[model samples]
Target: MKKTGITLCLLAMSVGLTSVVSAQTQLPNSDFEDIQSISGVADNGGQPYNYEYDSLGQGWISGNPVNRYLEIDHIFMKDTSFTHSGSHAIVMRTDSIGPVVAVGNAGLGEFVFNESNPFASIVFGAPFADRPHAFAGWYTYKSVGGVAPSDGDDRLINGDSLLILCYLTKWNSTLEKRDTVALASWTSSETVTDYTEFMIPFNYFSSDVPDSANVMFLSSSLGYVADFSERPFGVKGSTLVIDDIRMHYSGAGFDEYAELNGTAYTVGKKVVVRLEELPSDASVRIVDMAGRNLVSRQLSDKESTFELAYSGIAFVIVRSEKGTLTRKLYIH
Candidate 1:
């Protein structure tokens, strides 16, 4: 008993020390707070979901709201079972989370049952003009009926499944049609036994969407396993637990620095400050630290090698037909 007590004390001390180090480093999740929550069906005619606080105090089992809400009794993994109607939607209140997703309901068809409600679904993690860089969670379907319905006999099965998506607010408020960005995909066969990690890049994102995306929706796309179709879909009779749905600002994907090829020019001769990759239709202006334009030249496709008798720290702003890229060089 004395040894166990010592071990516990040591562990607590270690945690304290680690916290101090993290505080100095300004790491993420330091002052993090769970800002927004969407679960267990608020009384405002909202979606139904279940919030399961795990033993580790880091997870929740919830349903996607829109269809049917269900409760599981601990037979499967994560949090027992999933409800389809709940549609497992939660809006995180992270300061640096992502370029968020939005919900739109513009041109949805008329609702036969509920005339006021045209459609019901949510979008997740679409970086429109406002937030062009986004990241989101992944889902995989694992029911018995093999994801697709044959004769429309209730496409969802009694097994296990997962749905993951984000809401881009390209549509109106009817909830019928909206644009979506699929970050990663997982089906029961792909993620169950061998699934570990997935990655999504920003260059592959579509840039034609608008900038009014602010809400996130996670609904079962009808009964389909992967809902890539831009129509209204529904999810019911299952549960999903989402954790670590975050965004990463990868520093502009490529090096913004202009490569100055020193080998192309001879050092013996005093040459002008020139660049080979300067755009043909660009205006190149070389300036000193005091904002004085020392040399100005109209560039072309060919490498421009000029004579620069002066040598110092200089700035080169190249305005090309494509865009403007700036760089600094030390002329020795």
Candidate 2:
């Protein structure tokens, strides 16, 4: 069973910071209704095979490598047959493409496939900073086995489970590396014929604010089980259908809603934050609705004020060794 500790060095290297004028906590196109058609050619033995498939619209990416030198097997596709809401949902299937049998996987980021070096495949996360309480979604799965290996390996086993995972990350300037602020992961092997709701609460490991978030879905937890050549080995015909993915802010596991001995209010174009007693490591961060940090600084005094450039709603988050407090600031 592959866990979340896989080295994301390639993923971190692909991340580039971009300025956002505004932000939103909700993910874009979560319903999987919007889609784009992709066409490509793949190597079928020594001949070329042409194919096309539907990809997740925008704000989402899959590791499917079409138009490659090897036989193309689409791991992700749009499914209309089984959906919790709307007209479409996402379907992932484990498939065999020539010498490789890979599990379907998708993430909320950008993906770049390296043909010469599959291990060098890169996936960088999108900009997100909000710390939600839990990640919620709907999904259904069916597991199947029996696929022969081209390399004369053992037949694929049945009852492989699927995985849904999300993580919050922050860049540590002193350590010069990305650190995980929170993580939520869920996996199951039980077959579900109908769409079922699921929620996974985040486990925070740091008091610092995150700068990015990564959400991923996989048809099999053992998708990354590589053979001697580093090719993924998995059971074919395993399918997972998912839709209506969202983040929940107010819930039982939320730590950001904890009581704090502080007050925050908007004064003119600036937001004022005052704490009764400031801890030595206490810090304040002001972010827009889309989770973009407007101001982030350590508290040197009991009271501090930050000026805002834009109007509307923003969040004032104060974190310390004691706990975390979040307040809303409306600038008109």
Candidate 3:
């Protein structure tokens, strides 16, 4: 009897391990391509929207550049940066309009938008007609040489010239300014040969602001600007370069799945489908192709697996804090 019991226990252990592996194959995971790029600029020279450009420095669909020499610069955002990722970033060319760069210049160093000049706010175009986009670049400025001049209200990372930094809100459609870590001064203790790095937060779009707003405006006060003067100063000719611009959702999407119980689970066999990986605090629901909700539960912990009976071609949908995921399981 002892020998028989030991054999059964070993068999059960093997079955459990196999069940885990199988179930993992059945659960769904998230992918990045599903999300769309809300706003950005590329290099191939196609219009993302309706707009006109002139050599005199004016994108006709929007407004005219005060300076004749300045035009919206072009670049190709790198794939490793923002383009293929999930969120947003906006850049500006800070040189076109100002007296030694003024702070009060309308839409000087930010994504400025309004009903009258919507085009002036977010101008859209493509560098290549075939490719999606090449770059989404902008410009800003910061005081250099520790000079807090009268017009220098805000200081940016690239001191003494155009500040080239990417703001997170411009990419994340769901986020606002208050939830981001504004760019502060770029500190480099080394010589000109030394490299300077900025520690940008992965989830800068999720940070809190002074108010609970969906559209938060970042200024020099919020790391977007540094201590140059009482107010943030705009440094002209300062260009913030962003290439391979992409957004990162961080929110999980549907991936894969597996079966945990029996190959032919009997009716009322207490069928439980274990998740291979859980993304966030998710809510689970078992449904049919016809969109009928058969089962629902919240996944607070890994122990929160799905329990159902054998049914034909059932789908398990997990809606978490990040996003929704779906997986198919068979029942007999």
Please tell me which predicted candidate would have the highest TM-score against the true structure. 2
Clashing pairs in 2: 23-290, 24-290
The weakest ten consecutive residues by lDDT in model 3 span 5-14
- Which 10 successive residues of model 2 have the least lDDT summed? 1-10
- Ranked by lDDT from best down, the candidates are 2, 1, 3
Q: Each model's TM-score, in the order given? A: 0.30, 0.62, 0.25
Point to the candidate with the largest lDDT.
Answer: 2
lDDT of 3 at 228: 31
The alpha-carbon deviation from the true structure for residue 68 of candidate 2, after best TM-score superposition, in angstroms, is 14
Q: Write the per-residue lDDT of candidate 2 for residues 80-160, one digit (tens) a residue.
A: 577788877777777755545566777776655555554445455667777788888899998775545567665344466
Deviation (Å) of 15 in candidate 1: 44
TM-score of 3: 0.25
Per-residue error for 152 in candidate 2, Å, reads 12
Model 1 backbone overlap count: 45
Clashes of each: 45, 2, 57
On a 0 to 100 scale, what is the lDDT of residue 313 in model 1?
A: 49
